[model samples]
Target: MLENIRENSQGLVAKIILGFIILTFAVAGIGSYTNSVDTSVAEVNGEKISQAEFEKAYQTQRARMAQQFGEMFETLSNDANYMAQMRDSVVENLVNQLLVDQASRDMAIRISDERIKQTIREMPAFQVEGQFDNNRYLARINQEGFYQSSDFRDYLRVEMTRRQLTQALVSSEFALPYQTSLLTTLQNQKRDIRFATISAKQFEQGVEVTEAEINDYYLANPGRFENQEKVKVNYIALDVNDLAKDIEVNDSDLESYYQQNIVNYRQPEQRRIAHILIEFGDDKATAKTKIADIQTRLNNGEDFGELANALSDDTFSGENGGDLEWFEAGINGEAFDQAVTALTDVNAVTDIVESESGFHLIKLTEFKAEQVKTLADVKEEIAIAVSTQKAQDKFFELQQQAAQLSFEFPDSLEDAANAVGVEVKTSAWLSRFGNAAPFDNAKVIDAAFSDLVLNERLNSDIIEVSDSLVLVVRLNEYQAANTKPLEQVSEQIKTILVQQKSAEKAQLLADELLATHKAGDDISAQLTANNASFEEKAAVARYGSDLDASIVREAFKLPHPVADAVVATTVKLNNGDIALIEVTAVSQGDEQAPASFEQQYSQQLAQAAYQSYVEALREQAEISKRENITSTSQL
Candidate 1:
């Protein structure tokens, strides 16, 4: 093959192939060759949304859902359909963000850096006692997954710009007076209605399921009585909180830990300085020459602030006399720190310093001297840290031993529990789709019902239920899937058949009454004469009805009474009974919709319009998505 290719390379055919290859590289670059596999969850207009980006976005979305749904989050997450929706939501959000960024760029929507900084400064989370706190701002952004202030600034700019676009679309939407009027008329429409309830219980008394009928239905639906394969699990749980309770820290331990970690307790010397930076752009000689000229000016008693404002490459600090703010050693690099630390007096200037960032001319404005604390000041904090460290070390040892024992002795978890000095706990009956308490988590459930544990009858390897909780399980009792005896479910079958027949009888009576009313005979009189109560409700709104909610919904679903004639219909009630609902009159509210309601409704319509706008943009945009990567083997 090599010889053939080599000989062909001199021919016209090979030359044509080589030309195409070169052109491909010219268009796509060498990255196209290196990245043999595409790892993007989605792509919009050739911009790839990498899998890592999707995972991060998914985590953020999951956290939001956890916060929003609270106790329901766990159950919802376990629901395959809901989780699929959640994954879809994450992908949609990523795609929408890319779309927004692309559209924003095309439309020239850009927020100023100063505006970004101002937005951060004004955030309530970053404020301390009604004032912006720099430390608080930094800590808050760090918690939000942006460790760098600049990164946070960029994030805020994008988010703010997105909000601006959304507001633009919303503000442009308007609901006309006629639109509001029509909406209010429909929303405030009232129906004067009456209903006659014919209870299923009246028919149920006469409907009976014989033994033969029960047997026949039970035989027909055999799978309905089949129980889910379940296991009663006896397992051992190890929790960090329980282990830490017995581990004690003495005064000697605290003294030793405090001394070993003394640097953490001491405050580093902070230096406040201003500097003019000229990056190594275009040519090293040009940058060097610029820095040297700045140094000469500084040496000749020239204004450093004015020079920085005019010549510094860092525009952010340049605008403020190149103030780099307060920072400690090792923060501004070793070379820069050496110059700042060597300054003896305030207003001391250093010669041009060369660092990885580029050339810098440092000017010292002020400094805060380092402070060391005695053992008494941070005694409590030290004690806690030392104690936690010791507990963690012991916990780690037990964690390893328990996992090893569970795996080595796969038949039982007792040995592992005893070795770790943890209690062996047991769980009530648990099936593939259901469990209780600690075992209720999806990960633990998956591990419990695994082939190794459920089929092979082996102990589970250590499962991390949470960061602090670990578990190893073995099947105590297993019940294979089996159908219940006919005798056991006979009563259940009877009740079902009885309900079916009773409901049919109820519907038949309702249909007959409805037919008579439609044929011009009053059925309400006959119902009342037969000892059936006619429940009459007047001026019933969409809500706040005394009738069954389902009936109210059905009544509202009914058309308005026409030409001074009553409208009647038959609807199946939720309780398996049937009701004859009659609407005598229908009326709309005389008053106009309130300002607040009109505003809210208009905003709702605007939101719907904005969504349509986004959909339209999506229709025009070229989008490719990978669905298989959305699921995890074990969530």
Candidate 2:
């Protein structure tokens, strides 16, 4: 089998293609805005940005945030208002990118075919067993809506140019030494503070949640106590690997393919050559005589290495027994190349050749002409290639058939399965947030929950589950959304009610205590009188302190204390507790700033420059959203 083509980061692609986006945004702390949709939802300087396009970009960002937010993703996504704001943010991001994309067009940059292919090779999604699978790459591009490879290449060209432009802007930015020094000093600055915790749990024992409170909370928040609707689907899968097994590759097919793509078989010319040189000596005549004698001795079968090492005046080659490394054509100047080429046979010494340098004797140590693999040598590889292509062609045919047949016979997937030569299979229960593969794929879940399949009891549209698998599914089993029993959630409701009351108590007390302290009633005296407790931490560095990070961040953001007066504030902790913080002193960092500070600050400023440049572009641009589509921008 042919080895996988190597994945290479293309230098040319970096120069002319989308270098700017990845280079700047990924390193500049703005990477989350890299992907967006491109059709007619909005217009930037007259280019259409469709709602569908915007939604695609929004989903991509959501998926990325899901990874970053982890446990918080569920809470954030479930909040309709938050998700709406996120969509508008996505629109803003998309518009910025579109501006860059439009600017890139003015530069008229392009990506070469080889570089685009290299990019495809480097994507792990197109690989199998650590090797780039050409079929998978093609199929994936097809699924993504680029029907032709050249069309995909053109898309890459447009995308790459945009990044190249942004990267150029970011690359040209720099931070001066004084700027970094100042920033590092401020960033590493220390603060001195005393703080006291008002634990919500302390008030919880006295916070009695009555039965009426639990019932009211549960009834008001019904959605929170309900189970997610789940469903099971039966589907027909058309897999490319199964189709490939059915393909019968003939010898003639391999031969024809080899002849059609003969360029891939070439092995360039190679040679190992050597020479003995007699640089014009004290007398040119003497050098000529000496080279002629050396040639005669070589012709008489004197050991070439021994004679050349002993007498050749080209001392570098002489030290290596007159052996030069492998020869490349037109490299050593015309005379030397001609002399080496003129030697007719391997080991045959050339005639006394006089050059500007001196007289020379040359020998062809080894030679190999350009090569092409014959059909017999690569028949197995060719067969595999031919069969895979044929299988892919069949898969496309069946994919279309499955889609059409399922649509034509909308009542069930049986007709489509029969037509596509695949058996009907069933999937287990899955929810909207399922993470199981195959059925859990976003496309599959979307299709399964679509109105046609779920409500109408009709066959779903064919979903491309992966590069190799195509599916058409129908509803089999369904679970309706329902709330849990009152008895089942009573204890959970009680806990929630208790926590809410406790947090209110803690906040009210913390606020009163803060007010009393700010009115010149010394906090220490007030705490002592109330038999309350407090902890004093000195010299709390901005980073790596034993105190809560949220508190630390807030503490640093607070204003520095004036002499004889402390800076004080109340902060909410993650545990629903409240803390009272009093800053007694603040001090600048005295240590030498780290070397990385300059580069880090430079990138930070570069990112800011990029954003400012994009914002300027937006101001100049005529951006319009669809009248019906409401987003945070309109708000």
lDDT values, one for every candidate: 0.82, 0.79
* Regions of model 2 farther than 4 Å from truth: 1-181, 210-229, 242-373, 386-425, 440-442, 458-462, 481-491, 512-533, 544-546, 561-566, 599-635
Candidate 1 local lDDT, 507-576, one digit each (tens): 8988888888877786767787545766777778886767788788888888877874558888888889
TM-score of 2: 0.48
- Candidate no. 1 TM-score: 0.77
Span of 10 residues, lowest total lDDT, candidate 1: 133-142
Error of 1 at 350 (Å): 4.7
How many residue pairs clash in each candidate at the backbone level? 0, 15
